[model samples]
Target: MELSEISKSEIEQEIQQSFEGLVEASKALDATRYFEFIDAERFVGLNADGTNWNSIVGLRELVEPGFNAVEKVESLIFTNVRISVIDLNTAILVNEYEQKILLKGGTHYKEAGGGTQVWSKASGKWLLVSISASSKP
Candidate 1:
């Protein structure tokens, strides 16, 4: 079904659900599950590290070290989130995030960032296609 066929409210709700899934997987540090929300074949985005990523393999290579080293998620919060439905099959979401994590060896890591993501419906499901994000320690 094309997103254009759905009401804007419905589209927004679908996007919300997808984002919630992403947040859950991220908080659990589940790389495999977390990536399900993305369109791996088409994904091209700016990483938190300020590098452009066009390959999921490269993204995994860069993020797995930190992902694997996390002992626990102390907190992960997205604030001031806003969603916009652009067109049939397209939407955008922007938000600011703060996270505190417990890494291996009991060290804590904190980060703050803002993110803009472009999502499109694929096979009737919303998949993240691109992201532009900024990060700071």
Candidate 2:
């Protein structure tokens, strides 16, 4: 589809929903659902751990440990979201996030950061093509 076929608001709404799905899945540590929002075949991203990954397997290995260590999600929220539509097939979203979790060892983990996600609709659906996260706030 062409850019003229879709309004910017529509694209923003789609990306917003996609981001929500990812956050919900992450909060619950549902890897399967979390991966659904990512474009596994052509994914590329810089994780919060400072590791850059070009494949889904790399992502799973780099991030799963923390997910597994979470005993409960105390809070997960995103604020100041900004979305830029590049075309009908692509959009970029940036946001600030705050997350607090209870670990299996009975310690609380808290983090606040700004992140970016590049979303693509090339495969007939919106999926994260790339991601980047900065250090805690």
Worst 10 residues of 2 by lDDT: 1-10
Each prediction's whole-model lDDT (CA): 0.86, 0.88
Judging by TM-score against the true structure, name the best candidate.
2
Please provide, for model 2 over 5-58, each residue's C-alpha lDDT reduced to its tens digit, 9 standing for 90 to 100.
458889999999999999889988888899999999989889887888878888
TM-score for each prediction? 0.90, 0.91
How would you encode candidate 1's per-residue C-alpha lDDT over 1-137 as one tens digit per residue?
44554578888999999999999998999998988998888888888777898877766776678689999999999977898998768899999999999999999989899999999996578999888888855
Query: Where does candidate 1 stray beyond 4 Å?
Result: 1-6
Model 1: weakest 10-residue lDDT segment is 1-10
